[model samples]
Target: MAYKKLSEQVQELSNPQRSDLFVKQFREAVREGKFDATFLTERFTMPKTFSRRGAEGTYQRDTRDMLFDVTPDFEAWFEETNEALAQTRRTGNVKPTAENIAAGLVDFKALAEETRRKMQASYEKGQALGKGRSRTSSGGGASKTRSRKK
Candidate 1:
C-alpha cells in the first residue's frame, strides 16, 4: 500500500530525485521523531574524531563485563565470582561455593579461561572496528596502525 501510494505520488512529481527525497523525508518524519528547535533538544553522540591536539583517550568496551547478559558460561563464572567475593573478609580472594567447584565454573581455572575468552572477543571486536573502512569518500582513510605495539 505504501509503495503503491509512493509510486502514484512519484508519478505526479516532476523530479526523479524528488521521489526518493520524498520517501526519505516521510521515513525520517516517522523515525527521526520530533525535536525541539530550542536549546532543550539534545542528544548524546559518540565523538567522531580525535581532539584538536591529536590526544588519544582510552575507552574500555567491556563486552563481557558484569556477565549478566552474556552466555551461560559467563553467567556461571559471574555467579562464582560473586560467591567467592562473598566469602572474602576484605583480605585476599576467597574460594567459591561447592556447587560452583563441582560444576567447574568461576574457580581459578574457570575464571582464567572465561577471562581469556572475553579478552579474545574484545580484541577481535576492537580490531574490526579500528580497521573498518569508510563508506563515504569524505570519511577518513584506512588506518594501518596495529593497536598493540610490536
Candidate 2:
C-alpha cells in the first residue's frame, strides 16, 4: 500500500466522523503488522515539500514545512515552542530559557481565527479572478479577417 503523508492523514482526522474510520484502519493495520513507525517518524521530523500549479503558470507551495508528531513529548514541545514565540511577540523581548519556553502562553484560538480569515480572503480573491477571466473571454470579439480561398 502507498504511504500517506502526515498532512493528508491530519486532514483525514479533521472531520470527527472520519476519526473513527481512521482509528479502525489503524488498529487493523497494527494487528496485521503493516504499520510503519519509521514512515511516521520521518514525516514528523522532515516532511516532503509539495507544490502545485497556480493561476498564470505560477507554482505555489501547498504544504507547510512544519514538524507534526502525535507523541505526547513532541506535542508538549510543539506547544511550548509556539507559546514561547507568542510570548516574545507580545512582550517585544526575546527571553530564550527553559522556563519561558515551558509556559503555555499562546492563544491558539486567536491564531486559528486569524488563519481562517486569511484563508477566506485568499479564496475570495481566487473566485474574483476566475469570474473576471470568464467575463472577459465571453465578451471578447472574434477575429474579423476571412480565411483565404483554398
Candidate 3:
C-alpha cells in the first residue's frame, strides 16, 4: 500500500468526525504550554543621507503590534465549518448549499473583525499605560564618547 503524503494526511484531520478531536488535542497542548506564540515586530530605518536634505545620520525604529490569542475562536469556527460542510455533503448535495456557505463566511468574518478590534484596543491601552513611564537608553544607538584619565 502506498503511504499518503504529509499534506494528504494533514487534510484528513479536517474530516468532520475528527475535527472535534483535533481541536480538543490542540487546545490541551496549548494549555500545557507546548506551543509558543511569537509577537511580530517591524523595524524601520531613517536614511543617513537624504537626496535633498543631505546627511542627517541613520537610525532604526522598532514598532510592536498587539498580541491576542484567537486560537479558541478559530478552533471553534473550524469545527463548526467542517460540520456544516460534512452535513452538506451527506445530504447528497453536489455543491454546498447557500446557507452552509453563508453561515461559515459570516461566522469567520465576524471572528476576524472581532479579533482585530480587540487587538487594536489592547495595543492602544498598552500605549496609554506606557506613556507614563520614561524610556531609558538601552545602548544600541550610535557610539558614545569616552573620557581619558590623566
Candidate 4:
C-alpha cells in the first residue's frame, strides 16, 4: 500500500530535488515508525534500469579489448604467481598442512568457549538478580506497606 506509493516516488526521481525529498521522507518515516522493512527496502532499492543490469558491469567493447591485452602475458603472470606462492607458503595465512589448521582451530575454539562461558555467567547473574526483584515486587502486588513511627 504505502510501500508501493513510496517505491514509485523513489523510482520516478527525475531530479536532485525529488531524490533529496525521498531520502528525507524515508529517514523521517523510519524514525516515526511509519514504514517497516518492506517499505524501507522498496524505498532503498536501485532503479529498474540499474536493477535489471546484473551488478553493474559494462556492456561495451572495452571488456573485449582488455581481455585480448591480458591474454598474451597470462601464462607468464600465472607462473610468477605460483612461484611467489611457493616462496611465501611457510609464512602465508592459509597453510596446506592439516596439523597447522588443527592447531589454529583448537586455539580459536578454546578462546571462543572461554568467552562464551564468561558471557553466560554474566547473563545468568543478571537474570538471578532480576528474578529476586520480581519476587519481592510480586509479594506486595497491588498492596501498600505500613510505616512505623516513634
Instruction: Give the winner by lDDT.
Output: 2
Instruction: Compose the digit string of candidate 3's lDDT tens values, residues 1-150.
Output: 222221222254545344334434544544676543333363222212223347566433222322324455545754665565456544353334467656664465655688899999999999976864535344355668878899
On lDDT, the stronger of 1 and 4 is 4
How far residue 95's Cα lies from its native spot in candidate 3, in Å, is: 25
Off by over 4 Å in 2: 1-90, 93-102, 141-146
Write model 1 residue lDDT over 1-150, tens digit each, in one string: 111222333334333323334334434433453211111122222212223456577432111101012344433543444344345444554467677677665476776788899999999998877666434534775886869877
TM-score of 3: 0.21
| lDDT (C-alpha) at residue 85 in model 2 | 36
- Per-candidate TM-scores read 0.21, 0.30, 0.21, 0.24
Compose the digit string of candidate 2's lDDT tens values, residues 17-101: 2333343444444456444433333323212233455634432223222222355543453344334433442346534455654
TM-score of 2: 0.30
Tens-digit lDDT string for candidate 4 (1-150): 222344343444444223333445455544674434333222233332212345755321110000112232433533443344335423445543567656773465665688899999999999999999999988857748777897
User: Global lDDT for candidate 4?
Assistant: 0.45
For candidate 3, the per-residue lDDT at 128 reads 75
- Residue 126 lDDT (model 3): 94
In model 1, where do residues sit more than 4 Å from their true spots?
Answer: 1-106, 133-150
**Residue 125, model 4: Cα distance from true site in angstroms:** 1.0
**lDDT of candidates 1 onward, in order:** 0.42, 0.47, 0.47, 0.45
